[model samples]
Target: MTAGTANAQRFREFKMPDVGEGLTEAEILKWYVQPGDTVTDGQVVCEVETAKAAVELPIPYDGVVHELRFGEGVTVDVGTAIISVDTDPGAGPAGAPAAAAAPEQAAAAEEEDAEPQGRQAVLVGYGAAPSSTKRRARKPQPGVPAQPEPVKAQLQAELNGRPAAVPTPAPVAPAAVPTPAPAAPVPPAARPVGAGAAGRPLAKPPVRKLAKDLGIDLSTVAPTGPDGIITRADVHAAAAPAAAAPVAPAEVPVAVAPAAAEPGIVDTAARERRVPVKGVRKATAQAMVASAFTAPHVTEFITVDVTRTMKLVQELKQDPDMAGLRVNPLLLVAKAFLVALKRHPEVNAAWDEARQEIVYKDYVNLGIAAATPRGLIVPNIKDAGGKTLPQLAAELGDLVATAREGKTSPAAMTGGTVTITNVGVFGVDTGTPILNPGESAILAFGAVKLQPWVHKGKVKARQVTTLALSFDHRLIDGELGSKLLADIAAILERPKRLITWS
Candidate 1:
């Protein structure tokens, strides 16, 4: 922070800078300091991931970290006050330690302090310093793979004790957009009142507009999409539904204006809609784009009969000890992956371009691709291979909530050796997913549905699901991916196999 006429007093704060090389805002991933933690210059005081890579942010000013403005994963725009520092402002070209504050700011602080006898310390950028240039680049992981399918390599690296490198998420077009046609309207499938509205609500303005444009009401639109979202098609269809009334001009404007306004805002949107391409999406996009074009990508699909696993979900629920806890097929699947990962550790490794090597991992900080209000973020469970069923489920739950609330810190999203996408939650039966950079593979879980199957010599209703594995052909071959995918399916097919394997 530059000094004003009051430079003799000294610098009182350090604000977060545009750290994405030129990016404007970043989610506060995590804070390593509270108000009074004494810190040295260059000591990592926080971990903030831009949309791309997980970045460990170091303190630029040495001082006691005064008040943390927000907790982990709070997105802060550039120039926002992050911490305050006590700096001896060197003679400002004129041998005198100037007050490190703007005259107006110093006066304001003085007034604020006099009233409450307490330092609310809310000058916005009271304790701020110019961000260090060093923090510009996120530290590269050890032995990162250049292969297209690095998600698996991420897992393998953990198993082999290698550091994971996540390419940052690709930058999404920064213009604020109304929800897409398919992504419009939140579900009417019934949720606790106002429970899931904090993050990105599923409804897009246009779809909402369409509903109003056609005289359909929002509550009346039975959402057919996940998270109770009402899609554009649903709105259009509902417009023609029987019992719909004549369109009202006033209500139609909110929905339709957004579409017209969206473009104008994009063209004239604050110079440019600036976004930080760091953290999970940023890292994932950079790595995937780099890998997809540089390294070859190969994907495989498998259909499995997970009837027993669904039955086991019920059995686990019946246990008195399991009461009050949420237990589902994912917990079992997570366990199965751990078991499978042990057998095919090769699947959880990365190809290092700098050294021309393939590195493997020993533990799994299994990442789950979570769609949050801030965009897609992946907060992984550290050392997931060691957690028990209940623990895993609980952690997953917390991770989901954190991401949805935009509270996922940079550290939480870092160091994942493997990842799983529960597309099943979205009613998706299959998808060829993208790989997280630096790791070897990625797994997608499809919806578990009831289907006819042969059981005990007779046809019976059984739960079934499909699994899709996307791998980096540079490091993983069809044979290896098949082995890993088959191993996972085998365990999900029979939970008892876990015991045998263990």
Candidate 2:
């Protein structure tokens, strides 16, 4: 309805709150409201997953939700108004004061007397409702797939065209069932009549669209919809008709050399296939481009005989104390990085654009660059400089595990002063690593392998590894950069030197 047609209201915007201390940003894991959805104060409006955990954030004010800025999985900063509430926002609930009661109000009453009769407690705070709920992952059932788990349940409002009302719960029920997605795989508490046969939930418009594009059916296909919302893929599968030509099995094309072609590797496939730059991959490319072009990058390489370091890893693995721990060359390489940082603190710093200066950190928030199913996430351990060898080793293992499982939060990936890229894990000797945006330097740890080397006047096999440092030349001069690289090389040369120098 047009504002002038009947009634129009000016609504106040509810900005994303800092749910926890020092939490400046959060990813909008799911939106519970779209514009025009009614919501009550203290009701859950959306679920945001912070670095530490997923939390269900409540609505700060009551009203009809007027708009949402983006789709689910959007990362937003504190103070960014994510939803608009069109109503009397500052108004308090049913009979409470205009604002939440202040602690001083209660304290003032105590000071009056044992029986402070007739004297009213003066409340002097804004009428904002107290938030009792905390942040958490989006609500999901057991054995549910990750992709189809739309920002359903825990949302007080509905998005786009989905119905917002939920079935009222019965008092005598064994347990309350969550509201079902209309045409999703997981049926509602009780499947509705006239739904898909075999008791499957029906598909929604978008899901139907997806299925149509994929050549699927709506009624015949099994649903993979959130809250029983029919997914597009399911619809397409159902819509797709079986073909008579499919009666024959597909023959495996045996790879054979062309009769008249050259004997070398055939051009069966293109050397490279172009993929659309979208989603996380596209965003990564953009961030890299911005950093590479804007920041003056200088690449430096140092080949080190890390034979002793490799041997130490094996010894640590067999040691009783390190039995349960995950011990690998990465641990020793990480130790070498710390040693190098202590010798050269300036290398472990970033160029602060907002402050218009170089910010040198006393503690190392060591970021270990990890490639995960979600994308590349560099979750770092804060104050890594102070942690002991064993503590750091355990922390690294936990960080890698969390990242690989698609559970690494944004907090884990931010506030990194320096980054260590383990290109060696990919079996590559070395490549000029890209600096993690704000950070001035990034170190690349390459593979360790036996190579012929001249040591003690004899040509013998030694565990050789290459160290590559990529720095922002605009911040780190060539001489300082070279010295930093050399210090890392020197530490790897003599492991005992770290005991003294570090």
Candidate 3:
């Protein structure tokens, strides 16, 4: 009969929804509301990130925030309660103990019934409660007997850094105990601490993966995490010694100079840092690797004088119709790429390996690669080939702005036929670019710099830039690739081509 008990009866817990596309878990990027803050129905409560994209989650009902179940940056499994709210605040405190006890009873009953029961419907996707939340009783092995309570208490006391009380033992006949066989000595360093009853080291899945990648043995790692769980830092600490160990005898002479001068003063390992790859960065890495090895890549490059294109960009900016639209060299480059795709529609096709057939696309979803703080993300403008220059400019502006703000949706990034990456903004000349996964070709637009060139049969300083095109060789022949690159360069060289071609 207290205020705490009254609020417990009115509390509603909100579980983490699937967000989209059957994602199993998401990292809590941020929280918008704190405990004691009143939130309305359909209020934005927090933002989370999945492998595909970052999404904001909204609370479905009105209530006063009771508690936040998870902190920022923690990856929580789907269907786990992430927050709790109290729907009624003015109720009198009565029968609080019984109300709270009811939930505990229900939870115990659910666990006792092992049959898979349907979970409460979620906002995004349907899923059964995860069985991993429950732990089954550990049964003793065939030969090993259970330790007596007194010995268990003594071990616990020692682990807690307290002197164990010695228990007086009754006299037993010596013949009753059998002599044990001699065992091989196990170094204290090799003994596995913080292990479960089954002798398996206590570490999370991500920590295990990290240990596997670093080739570090988990049993040898000391646990510093709560409840004797091995954490990522523990794994990294275990691997640091191996990485900083002395080099082999062949390279010992090379390291001797530094060793002799510093004499352990400089710790090279401390200068190194490791970051766990997750979210968008992790997905991008896996996709790039698959694309590079599975498809044969052929790159072709061309240099073009883009002085005319620069003039057009300036003209467009001054034009009344393009007043609010973003008009830059990249816009013209994107338009030029679309024009080239129109001339050679076959370049927009994808090689479907499973079907062993060329799937030629009718419309172009032109992907524009934008580098954000999260990493490189390419969000395409749908049906870009069919849109007017003004429409394309507007959509392109929104796409880039959304990407830079880290709000681009996953749907906006899929089903692309071709892509253009502008490396000019970074002041790079040009280099071979990789094709995005499932796309046929990618165009790299480089910096435009003044250079000496022959024009009108006279040497003059002209604005020039190099363009690199990388395509899937299995689908595009060298001749086709060359033509696509040439067309893009030609349009940029003579901006009049854009008007005439359309």
- Candidate whose lDDT is highest: 3
Kindly list the per-residue Cα lDDT of model 1 for residues 1-502, writing each as its tens digit.
Answer: 2434343234456677655445666666566776657778888877665663345677777655544544454566678766665454233321222356554454333111121333222221112112233233344343342234468646534432337765564334334543222233344334332123322223444444445544567676665553345565565455433323432222221222336646654323323334545555565567668867875678888888898898889999988777766788888888898888888888878888999998888878898888865456667899999887778878888888777766576667667777888899989998988777666777899999989988889999888899998888988888988998899998998889989997
What does the lDDT come to for candidate 3? 0.77
TM-score of 2: 0.52
lDDT for each residue of candidate 3 in 1-502, tens digit (9 for 90 to 100): 5544454558888999887666788888888998889999899999998777788889987878876766666678899888888787555322323334653343222111112245421111112212246455566554344344678667644543348965655344355564343344443345355665335666655466667756779899998764456676677678655544542222221222365656776655544555678888887898899989988999999999999999999999999989899999999999999999899988999998898999999999999999988888889999999998899999999999999999988889889889999999899999888888899999999999999989999999999999999999998999999999999999999989998987
- The candidate with the higher lDDT, 1 or 3, is 3
lDDT for 468 in candidate 1 is 91
Task: Estimate the TM-score of every prediction.
Answer: 0.52, 0.52, 0.68
Off by over 4 Å in 2: 1-279
For model 1, the superposed segments whose C-alpha errors exceed 4 Å read 1-9, 17-49, 52-284, 320-324
Per-residue alpha-carbon lDDT of candidate 2 for residues 52-102, written as tens digits (9 for 90 to 100): 345677886777776564345456778976776767545442222223445
Error of 3 at 49 (Å): 2.2
lDDT agreement with native, every candidate: 0.65, 0.66, 0.77
* Candidate 1 positional error at 124, Å: 29
How much lDDT does candidate 1 score?
Answer: 0.65
Q: Which candidate is the best by TM-score?
A: 3
